[model samples]
Target: MKALFDTIKIYPKLIITFLIVLTPLFTLSLVMNKYGSASVKSEITNSMLSKVHFYNSTLENEFGRTIAIMREFARYDDLDLLSNRTEIMNYYEQRGAIRNLQKELSVIKNSSTYIQEASVHIPSIDRTISDDNFGTIQQDEFDALNVLTNHFESPFIYWQDRLFISLPYPIKSNRQPPDFVVDIEISIPLLKNALLQFTNHTAGNTMLVHFEDGWRIGGDEPEGFLQAINSVIQADNADNAELHSATVDGQKYLIAFEKSKTLGTTLIMYERESTVLGPLDRYTVWFWMISILTLIVIMIVSYSVYRLIHRPLRTLVRAFRKVEHGNLSVAFDYRGRDEFQYLYTQFNAMVQRLQQMIQEVYEQKFRVQHAELKQLQSQINPHFLYNSLFILYRLAKKSRDENQIRFSKYLSDYFQFITRNSSDTVTLAEEVQHAKNYVEIQKMRFASQIEVAFGELPASYVDLTVPRLIIQPLLENAYKYGLEEKETGAKLTVQFAEDQADLLIRVEDNGELADEELIANLRRKLDVQDAGLETTGILNVHRRLQLQFGAEYGLVIAQGESGGFSVTIRLPRTTSM
Candidate 1:
């Protein structure tokens, strides 16, 4: 995944990161929204269920009171006296008995608001007296009456296209089966009105279902409403006050129902999903709008960040690219206050320093080549000329000298060796021979004053290449500073040995030091290049050793084993020269 992301450009990468970060927030928002809606729905369902239960109890109590009134009228002694009146009155002329029955029902009807009519039946006279102005019974109600319980309340019944609650009580005077039946009718519209009052402020419908006849009261049913009712009934959850969810006609609803045991009706309260979830729908739309706006803002922020960081980064890359191609003069032009600006300033400084260093190196190289060419052009072997002229002049003045011819031959041989300037470097054997010729010339000058020793070197080491004039300068320094003033017993030794990866050539002189600090100071000067003084032969030899080999191979001064000053020349065992 990291490699895949690395291949992507910064803009897309930032966009993808925003998406990765936003996914969880979007998910959380959706989850909380759904949870909030469900919570609200549950609360509203519980509230509606509570109201349904309250209304159910109210209906139960109202019907209970109606039953109680029916029971009271059935047990009244004055009303029961009508059961024996048929034996005293002729069937055609009992108008006074009928009037008394009507007066009694009228008094019962006026007692409560629920009662729609009241009536008493005489089987012997085949007559019924009622408080209703019609004072008659339809054939279907009469036929249904025969099948009802004589001393109990009946289920809700339809009569004349209107629902009614009937309570029938059989009157018995002498242990006979029944002399007459008393029926009390309470209007169902009053019950519907009571249900409607409870739901005036609610968002849904309230209803009562008659279990015996599948009749519904209190509200118009929507499409598939009957199916939803059937599902509730099948679940046998009519006694439960808990709310249920159902979809009716492709529209969702919350349904809560309760059964009335006394009335054989189930009270159902239902709310459509759209109505109950209206606020949630709006909230969802608003949330989406906010999420879109937030995404837009985040995108803007991402673009801004890319410009702030990426453009500067690209500039750095381009500057480095120029430097990589050897354009050391390249520099950044940024002048902002952020960290990148600091980096740009530092980068510019570094480039300037690098350019200066490179130019110094080039100029130093040019100076070195120019000096070497000039030295080559002016080379005339002055040491050989001075020594040869001195020896020739001294011999000419002393013509009778015994060593005159020998010295002349030696000087001729020395000039023959010294005058050749074929290469800047030569074999160790050649350098040793050149030093031997210089020593031969110096011996003529200080023959009896000092003793000079040249140590033996291996033939394999003799062929190694080394800088010319390197050994002769140290020999000259030893003779000039440490041995020239000594009258006798002054010794100069030139010895060669390999020291690990380096080769050492020690030139020793057993001479008293007037100032030991002088040697120490000279050794210190050899350690630094461009010491800013006229280059002595020894100092020139030390610088050449380092320039050819490195800083580690140079010259150092120490006391020799013979209690005299020793100059040690260190050089690598292998050299490019």
Candidate 2:
């Protein structure tokens, strides 16, 4: 898996990542659309139910108000006084009573638009007073009124052919049967119109179901829709006030119901499911369209990025691989005016600089090897010259020629000592022997004018190796620069001592020129790091000692006792000779 991902290009990687993120977002949008659709349908049904409840409440209030008005009319004092038979016996009193009753009924009828008629029947005179003259009552009308009187405090209601909602108030004298009945007839058409004004149903039906009498107030409903509501009303436990769902006429609906216990009526509001959730379906379609467009846009952008960025970066990666393999000559010459172009230009310049550095390093190594070969050849030439001189010195010694013998021996020994350059380093004893040979030669040249002495070194320090020709130069300098200038013969002494962890070899000479100024001059020259061999001959020996051992093992020049110049050669005490 890891290898497959590593081989995939940058463009594919970005597209894969975008698709992975987009998948979950698309799923969440679909889930939200479904949830929002259900929520919208529920809210619409609840809102319609709220309006139905308002209408029911208004109906209840109107019914209560009408019943109260009827009770108020029953409290008339004239009706209470008419219980006496004497008031109906006198012709003048009877005539005054009938006129007063007519005027009161007229006033009651005029008080409300819902009241169509008002009338009072008296059994004693077998006569009825009314707010309007509607001819005469038939036998069937009288029988219906007689049966309705039996149900006390009930409204006289019927909806077959004609509509009526009347309240019958019976007047009882001295706890006997009612002396007469007062009826207030409410206009059914006007009441139905008033109830319909509160309805807001778009599809489906709204009804005020009077369950007690099996009559509904709202007009014009489909038979199936009406049956569905009536079935729920007839069901014993259908008093639940919450909105519910039902199917009627092969169509889905959301139903909301509220039952009024006081009026024995139920308020039912319902609308078709498809109609209520119609907008949600439209919204879902729109959301899917937008989502598809978004995916298309992402695809277009991914392709553009692959061309502009990923392709150039891949080329840079290839260049890096070449550099890793030591090929600094590789170059990237991307030509467009973008960030990658600038980076490629700089990278190509860097490769050129790296190539130059590589060439310079190779040339430096060649020069170093040449110098080492020349140094070896130079050592060989000196060894051949010194061997010939050694042979000539033995021939002179055999002849017993003192001057020639002395000169030949010293020259031969000096040449042999300096020319034996098999290596740059030798033991301290060998270095000291070379120094004594050079001093003897110098003594022969100066006669008894310079006296010289050699001191014995410790047995333990004799085998330490040091740079050859280091001590002989100091001894030669003491004779040519110091002892030769003095009138009295100067004493030259070579002494060895140990100071701390080093072997100190001191060469001191007492001469006229070995004063404070000469000692200071010699010390100053030894202190200089870059002094050349021709300018500072003694300083060259000091620098070689330092390079061979370390900075601590070097020559230090100073003043000795009673006008003598002392040069101390410091070397590390090492057992590896």
Best by lDDT: 1
Error of 1 at 451 (Å): 99
Best by TM-score: 2
* Local accuracy of candidate 1 as per-residue lDDT tens digits, 257-351: 78777777778887786787788889989998999998898889888878778667878889899998999978777767889889999999999
Q: Across residues 108-189, which tens digit of lDDT does each residue of candidate 2 receive?
A: 8777766777776554455566765523444354434433422223354553434344333454445543555566666767
Q: Spell out the clash pairs found in candidate 1.
A: none
lDDT scores for all predictions?
Answer: 0.72, 0.68
TM-score of each: 0.46, 0.47
Every model: Cα RMSD to truth: 28.6, 29.0
Output the TM-score of candidate 1. 0.46
